[model samples]
Target chain A: EAGVTQFPSHSVIEKGQTVTLRCDPISGHDNLYWYRRVMGKEIKFLLHFVKESKQDESGMPNNRFLAERTGGTYSTLKVQPAELEDSGVYFCASSQMRTGELFFGEGSRLTVL
Target chain B: ELKVEQNPLFLSMQEGKNYTIYCNYSTTSDRLYWYRQDPGKSLESLFVLLSNGAVKQEGRLMASLDTKARLSTLHITAAVHDLSATYFCAVGSNSGGGADGLTFGKGTHLIIQP
Candidate 1:
C-alpha cells in the first residue's frame, strides 16, 4: 500500500496570508492525524480524524487554524492570517487501526515571512 | 497531561561502540513505539513494545519496555555509520482499538562516527 502523501512539499506565504496543506492517507485507513514542528522545537500534535469525523482537536493552536476531513478520504489544514511564528514543518500520518503504528508523510514545510 | 522524555538528547560515539537511549513517560500507557528519522526525512518505525518487559530487536537495534517503571530503552549494539539518525519514542494511551493519538518524546540525535 502507498504511504500517506502530502501536497506542495513546501510552501511560502507572507504574514496575514492564508495557506492550505493537504494530506491523503493510506487507503482504508480510518485514523489520520496532523502534527507540526517549529524551529528547534519538538513535534506537537494538532488534531486527529477518524473516518470523516473530528476525533480530537484539543491540540489545535488557535482559531486561525482550521482542519477538515470531508468524505472521510483526505484531510486539509488551512491557516488564515498566518504569522511568522507559524512557519514550521507540518506532518500527516495514518494508521490502519486507532492507536496503532502510524505511517508518516514527508511533511510540508511552511515558511511565513 | 501525558509527557514523554528521552535522555541524552544528543549522542556521538565511534563505530562498533555500544550505547543505550532511554525514554521515560508519565502515567500509564497502552504501548510504546520507537522510530528512526534521518535529517529532513519522515519517521521510520523501528519497534513496538506492548506489554511489560516486552523486548523487540532488529538488526543492531533493540528496544525494551518496562510498564511498571514507565520506562523504555533502545540499545544499540555495535553501531555503524548507517545507524546515525534521530530516534523517537512515542507513548499511546489505553484507548481501546487505537482511538487515541501518541505522545512523543523530544527525540535523541545519534551520530556514529566511522
Candidate 2:
C-alpha cells in the first residue's frame, strides 16, 4: 500500500509570501497529523484531523498557519506571509483511529528567503 | 506542557560497539514511540512502547519503556555503519488511540563508523 505522500517536496518563497503544502494519506486512514522541524531541532506537533474534523489544533504556531482536511482524505497546510523562521521541513503523518502507529511522508521542505 | 528530552544528542562510535540513547519526559504519557530518520528522509517508525516494562526489539535495535520513571531507552547492539541515523523518542498525550499529538525530543544523532 502507498504510504503518506506530500506534494511540492521543496518550496522556496520570499518572505511575506504564502505557500500551501498538501498531503495524501493512505486509503481508509482516519487520522492525519502535521508536524514541523525547524533548524534541525525537535519536531513539534502542529495539528491533527480525524476524518475531516479537527480533533486537536492546539499545536498550531499561530493564526498565520491554517490546516484543513475537507473530505477526510487529503489535508493541506497553508502559511500566510511566511517568515524566515518558517523555513523548515513540514512532515505529514497518518494512522488509524484504533491503531496509533503513525506512517510519515516525505516532508515538504519550505525555505522562506 | 509536556516535554521530552533526549540525552547524548550526538554520538560517534565504531562498528561492533554498543550504546544506549535515553529519553525522558516531563509529564505522564500513555504511549512512547521510537523513530529513525536518515539525512533528508522521512521519520520511520522503529518501535512503540505501550505500557510500562514494554520491550520491543528488531535487528540491532531494542527499545524499552518504564512508565513509572517516565523514561525510555533505545539500545543499539553491535552497531554498524548502516545504523547511523537520527533517533527520536515521542510521547503521546492520550491513551491507545490516534486522537492526540505527540511531544518529541530533540533527536539523538548516531554515527556508527567502521
Candidate 3:
C-alpha cells in the first residue's frame, strides 16, 4: 500500500503571504496527525483528525493557523499572513487505529522570507 | 503536558564503534517509537516498543523499552557511516485509545566518521 503523501514538497513565500499544505493519508487509516519542526527545535504536534472530526487541536500555535480534514481522507493546513517564524518542515502521518504505528509522509518545507 | 528527553544531543563516533541513545519520558505511555531522519529528509520509522520490557532489533540497531522507569534506549552496534542521521524518540499517551498525539524528544544527531 502507498504511504502517506504530501503535496508541494517545498514552498517559498514572502512574509505576510498565505500558504496551504496538503496531506493524503494511507488507505483505511482513521488517525491523521500534523506536526512541524522549526529551526533548532524539536518536531511539535499541530493537530489531529479522526474521521472528519478533530481529535485534538491544542498544539495549534495561533489563530493564523488552521487545519481541516473535510472528508476524513485528506488534510490541509493553512497559514494566513505567514511569518518568518513559520519557516520549517511540516510533516503528516497516519495510522490504522489509535495507538498504532504511524506512517509518515516526506514532509513539506516552508520558507518564509 | 507530556515531555520526552533525549541524552547526548549530538554524537560523533567512528565506524565499528558502538553507542546507545537514551530517551526518557515524563509520564506513562501506551507505546514508544524510534525514528531516523537523514539531513533534509522526512522521518523513517525504526522500532516500536509497545510494552514494558519490549525489545526489537533490525540490522545494526536495537531498541528496548522500560515502562516502569519511563525510559527507552536505542543501541547501535558496530555503527557505520550510513547510519549517520538524527534519531528521535516519541511517546504516545493512552488517551483516544492510543490515538492521542505523541510527544517527541529533541533528537540525537549521530555522525559516524569512516
Candidates in order have lDDT scores of 0.91, 0.92, 0.92
Which pairs of residues collide in candidate 3?
A99-B98
Query: In terms of docking quality, how is candidate 2 classified?
Result: medium
Better of 1 and 3 by lDDT: 3
lDDT of 3 by residue, A1-113 (tens): 78899998999999999999999999999999999999889899888899899988988899999999998889999999899999999999999876678888999999999
Query: Can you give the TM-score per candidate against the true fold?
Result: 0.96, 0.96, 0.95
lDDT of 1 by residue, B1-114 (tens): 779999989999999999999999988898889999998889898988899999999999999999999999999999999999999998987744433668889999999999
| Candidate 3's TM-score | 0.95
lDDT of 3 by residue, B1-114 (tens): 788999989999999999999999987789999999988777899988898999999999999999999999999999999999999999987755434778899999999999
For A7-102, candidate 1 gives per-residue lDDT tens digits of 879999999999999999999999999999898888888888999999888788999999999999999999998999999999999988764678
Fnat across every predicted model, in order:
0.38, 0.72, 0.68
Off by over 4 Å in 1: B95-99
Q: What does the lDDT come to for candidate 3?
A: 0.92
* Deviating ranges (above 4 Å) for candidate 3: B95-99
What RMSD does model 1 have? 1.8
In the predicted model 1, the residue pairs found to clash are: A98-B98, A99-B98
